[model samples]
Target chain A: MKSASPLPVVFAAFFRAGLRAKRTRVFILLALVPLLLTLLVRVVDPKESGDFFTKVMLSLYFQLLVPVLALFFGSSIVNDELDGKTLVYLTTVPVRRRAVLLGKYLAALLLAALLVAGGFLLCFLVAAFGRLGEAAAWGELGVFLGAALLALFCYSALFTALGAFMKKSILAGIFFVFGWESVVQYFPGVTQKFTVIHWIKSLLPIPPGEGGFLIFQLQPSPPLPSVLVPLAAGALFLWLAVLIFERKEYILSDNA
Target chain B: MSTVLRAEKLSKWYGNILGISDINLEVAGGITGLLGPNGAGKSTFLKIAAGQLKPKIGRLTVFGEPVWGNPGLFRRVGFCPEHDSAYNEMSGGAFILLLARLHGFAGAEATERTDKALAAVGLLESRGRAIKAYSFGMRQRLRLASAILHEPEMLLLDEPLRGVDPLWRIRIMQLIKDYGRQGRTVIVSSHILSEIEAMTSEIVLIHQGKIFAKGDIHSIRGLIDSHPHQVSIRCPQPRRLAGQLVAGEFVSGIEFAADGGGLTVRTDQRDRFFSALMPLAAQAGNEITEITSPDDNLQAVFDYLIGK
Candidate 1:
């Protein structure tokens, strides 16, 4: 038998398709919201732009947008195929199921990363326009981008596994983001560590007393563990997604 | 003949509803028409064979290996599903080319196969158009093109002719016949008996989650032909036509229309009855306006066979 097409071929085709997808367009608009907010704060009060940018990055970008964007992009990796009844085409190919899932997952991850990076870069440039020459300011931007990447990797992988496990994964993801992450991250001591946001929040360069109601009493974990936990968890979740996808028999139609 | 597909005591059920039950059969290469009515076990059996669904009980194997979770088997198998589904965003050529690439064809070879498959299905000119813009019949043909683009040893088509125009239907049927003639296994499923009958003489009759019968079409045709058939004839002189039909050896019984506009004739031999009715209606005195066999369809024949 002929060898199946390489993983790059599947990744390239799906990546191009993912860019044109309607969901990606919606995400592009969603990612732009932070940039718009940064611009508005910069114009109204230039002195407070730096501080507002930090708050926006923490509450909106990291806590809300990153996880939600990952949820949309990552869950759709499997859900979209099932909904469109296009899974048959992918499953029937000579390639292994793991290759198909990983190829699509990589496409979704890249697409989500582009959205977050584009929006974050613009928001950072607008907020730190006056401080561009300073090394410390550039370092802070790098840290934020690094934290955002880690948060996205962790969240997207988690949601991708959820999508493979259940059909109505968006509902479950919404609850995890709002109900579990929102409430659990604020809990004192070790309990907050259970939520993914705790590790993400620890990586952010937020001063102890500055985040108001969102992170006033937040006990951030050490930077190393924070970064390591998300990386390890993301890898675990991604492996789970592949495991479920390969073994599970998805019924394309009404059992026919 | 070497067995291409085998199902040993295979059964599948979705909760309370049974799909196929205890289906033990072996299919050899050449066209085997899966003849059944709607909601019969035909689609279920095909889906299991295609590796789309796992059997709830027993096993189904294609080319001696289990089909479920066997992506490698697809290298030798092509399946056109029953649902009218496609990536509406992609052009017909693009869709076929993607499947070609997935099947391991690269560069010019993928494009060539795509071109050939599209041309075979008469979609070559409109290959660049998005599938959504095409009519239902066009999409059906596109699905057929996708399945054949790989040129696998076995083709499993589930209601492939559905929504196809009459002109293309004959062409598609001929294409399937050519595949059979080339010594490949082509299993085409359809609810219509004449559709399957026109394609191949070998058939498997499935109904209510079971294989009711399997053999040459002639045997099933014999059973249907022997069943009492009702022929309704509208005529100006119903009494005269009934009087003539009463003497025929094929006429088992006759009933006059309550409206006095037509007569319903029961015949044991439908072909002979039709032959006798033609001459009577052609006579100068007899004026037959219309003639229809009410139970001439396969559904009625199935109902009689299954004692439904």
Candidate 2:
């Protein structure tokens, strides 16, 4: 019998469910944080609004918010099912395990993208108030948005693979985001390249040395490598997630 | 009948603890009850057959294909897991619909299959309600609906009737019977002897991760009847009843309850003992109020068979 393609089916089902999830509600509110802060900057000091958007706002979204969102969404792609004991439902279907992982990954990625893009757009509008009409300002907004998507793609895939491999991957994911990404990104030379945030921050419009130590410090990688690194890493992580999901034997209950 | 599922020397374990060990079984069409106490490897065995877990040592196949990593084999197999789990946010209709779509149905066909499955389990009216709002029984029925939604030829149900109300229990039993009548392969697991007895006479008694017995109920019961059985009888005159019953050949020993209101009788021939006791009790002033076999449960049966 010719079976319907499982990827689209799983994607649609999980996407609709994720939209109504309580986590999504909290994220919608969390995504508003950057927009709210940009509004504060616009109100407090109109003259440095653009500078704040480029240096501080970009750092906040790229370094903190985007990766955090990706971590939660991507890791949850498999972790939620494991904890909930709902992986059986997905696995028992006449669909490949890879399809299930990829479908849920896509659904999660889309949700994360929407949240980051929506907040970034609102923040961009407020920070670039008068210069909104200029192509340069819009062009900057496009670059930041592109970088945010790439970051989410790469980080979420890594987390998804971690989740598929281990039950308590979120703990490790938090350490990576707050610990490794935070500490390693500031190590001056080649060490910063070890972090995913390095490739992401390299793509930002804000030049290095402008945003102090917390933001970018050294020369960014060439634009081609910046885009390719995250893309290639994301693909590799996603492939790993699919491999782990397909082969791993999950023990759902302690009922022996 | 051709075999639908086969496990060859299949074994699995969690750490040092065993799940199922060296299990070799072949099942054909019709209902076969997996009878065992909790943690007897029923769920573990079913999970392996359903492709939820890979066997540590050996192989399991459905439709001549390895169950693990064989998704297409599910097109002819259905599994209702023991755990009470579902996406709480999604409505029942949506959940079943998603599974139907996964089975390759689309558009109006998927909708029809979903509705038919819901209706079969008597959840059609509650289809729009969120699964979290469902009672334990309703969730169970919903899980049943999910399994049968695709109308697979082989069905594996792990404690499907658990937490279901009496009314729904009978309905679900009838539904399972209907599945068997259609010549479909159904392997239903339960710790309750009568529950399995009610569904099918063919049973595989599993204990401590091994199959203790496999046959019709009559044959297994014959093996069990030979074991010494304790029958607790509550009577007004326990000493008098014990005196009248102690002389029988089937009566092995007798113990008086601490309360002095009941007598426990150990009988080598349970059927013969009951036959003699019925006439003796009806005679006069023997007035037996209650008669219960504490060891009637599957656990006690396993213990007796294993010489515990």
Best by DockQ: 2
DockQ of 2: 0.56
B268-291: candidate 2 lDDT, tens digit per residue: 788788778878767677777656
lDDT of 1 by residue, B59-167 (tens): 9999999988889999899998888888887888888888888889888888899999999999999999988899988899998998898888999999888867555
How does candidate 2 fare on TM-score? 0.88
Model 2, stretches more than 4 Å misplaced? A1-3, B222-296
lDDT of each: 0.86, 0.89
Error of 2 at B9 (Å): 0.9
lDDT of 2 at A236: 98
